[model samples]
Target: MKISRRFAGLAALLVAGLLGTTVHIVTTAESADAAQTSLRAADPSVLRVGGTYVGVQSVGDNGIAVRQASSPAGLATAAARTVFTDSQRLGEVWAPEIHYDGGRYYIYFTMGAGANHRMYVISSATADSGYGGATKLNLPDDRWAIDGTMFVFNGQRYFVWSGWAGTTNVEQNLYIAKMTSPTTATGSRAVISQPRESWERVVGNPFINEAPEAIKDPNGQLHVTYSANGSWSEQYCIADLRLRAGGDPMYVWDWYKSNGCLFGSNRSTMMAGWDPTLYVNGPGHHSFVLLNGDINTSPPAGSSFPLMFHAVAKGTPYAWSNRYWYTGSFMWWGAITYSRANVPGSTTNTGYSIKFFE
Candidate 1:
């Protein structure tokens, strides 16, 4: 498998974490102006087209912004030509990730409020035309699900999302199922990852393992990154997992996780009541993009890749406006395998310690 096109874009996310290993990462713009993307960022998602960064984000209750981000940091500032709006209950429509497949653009987003929140999709031939009429997927295990994303492996389409294990909300877990089409799931969902780590379960009662994003390494291994903890708190962070070599993705025994959070809270120098942007908090809900070069070309060992995400200035409430978009680059350590998936999760099949930006 080649790299994810999502990785082909510029750094479109801001994440925080210090994996216990010597990493050759270039993380800049650690401090950013929060007011820029304010109500526009919550679950920020974008795709790079040529030199332009195109994205869709929550505008407000019942609204969406089909945005042309001027830069990774310049969301909400760019053209708002691509958008979706409805008076019908879209209650805090969040995590709008855009993907292009078969020469078409598809926006996968979460809509509705509370338990009513579920994933939906809209498409347009070109982003300039704007997406229309959100449609929910016919999922077999259709419970409370959100942050749904799609990936294709060996020509087979698959859907991964964060959902409640039961009817009532207890905790959010990562699930994968076969997708007959972009808008339909064809089989029972397999539970892959959950909030088993203490850092992942920090407060908000119901722990989270949301925002399952897929990325491919140069070696053709399949891996996914996810957000952990509560988004409402500064404790919110990012973690990841990978499929075992030659392991069946549908089986719970096929996936493994890192020892700890791959991306979490950024620790930086601070003064008393430091600039909110100076020390970012809870860098999560992000997507990956290949910094440069052709997506099909296998980058040499230790090539730097960019990432972007929404973050709040330190000491600020986790409000919509407080959250801003940030960008940076990190180097990959190739396919070097040292540590193992020492952490616990749904499967006993521990994998090689898969590190991101290390």
Candidate 2:
């Protein structure tokens, strides 16, 4: 099994402080348009130092609830809003991966329906405003799906998630779908990885593989990671696929599971935690935030927020235990790094810059 993982270099983190430095913009197609509402930026900042955040129970039994610190150095504050609270129709919304691209913010998350959950897209002219209604993509064959993450490789975008090859639900496989747009997918959902492998299997409910997150290294290698086994004792694992410049991303996503678990259950450099989460454990399902501070500053902006789920203490390194949190809840941001470092094959040389539209 091939896995592509990168470790970043030790560099200073910078916080932007110039006026006009902050911008909020959102644009979308007409038919799917919903009311536009302004989102509030929590004071003190939720992603603070030594703070804790916990996911709020559903107010009306719908949508994910998130809370965090107000300042980079303060106590966590709480807040909630229904992004997609139509339980009778959409059911529970989970794991929202927020992205900022092309002057707009696109939030990709899993929405539940009846016994199955599929991925959907919501947009806001601004990163932290009330997003318009969602557009659900018809996942190939309508297999039970969840944990949808949007990724861009070599200038092209793709969606990766967990689903069953057939309807049995006994085997949840990792699949990728090509995107015609942020809200729609073209072509069939291709199977990238399956739980049948010895390293991918687990024992319990939802018994299978799920939740895939992919990122590229400075050398342009693609690293995809996901969680397997039952949710209660969930395990986080990673694998790799390579994409050459101008190569079809779909073809580049060939499946090959990693050698072992990156972090989960009893194995990991980081302590094992349920949800087998990532991207800075916060208010939602396995999420990660990339705050690309100025290349010359220290402790970059958007660096802290409250803890989530279990309400543990914050202030540890961003990659500390499963208890840190952040409050931006929603906001517009940008990163300016040319390539990712610490990835496998440090000797390989390749570089590219990424500018996402949510």
Q: List the global CA lDDT of all models.
A: 0.64, 0.42
Positional deviation of residue 63's Cα in model 2 after best superposition, in angstroms: 1.4
lDDT of 1: 0.64
Error of 1 at 318 (Å): 4.3
Write one digit per residue (lDDT tens) for candidate 1, span 1-358.
3223234212222221233432223232223321334433667676666667776776656666676654665655676664677557657677787877766778888887788778888888887575679898876667888999887765678888999988889999998999987778897999988888655666557888898877665455577778887888777777667777776777765676654565556322111111112356777787675322122322323333456677786677776567777664344432233233444444343333222321
Best by TM-score: 1
Q: Which ten residues in a row have the lowest lDDT in candidate 2?
A: 4-13
lDDT tens string, model 2, 130-221?
Answer: 67777787777777787776666555667888777777656777788877666777778787666654544545455566656555534445
**TM-score of candidate 2 to 2 decimals:** 0.57
Q: Report how far residue 226 has shifted in candidate 2, in Å.
A: 1.1
How do all models score by TM-score? 0.78, 0.57
In model 2, state the lDDT of residue 158.
79
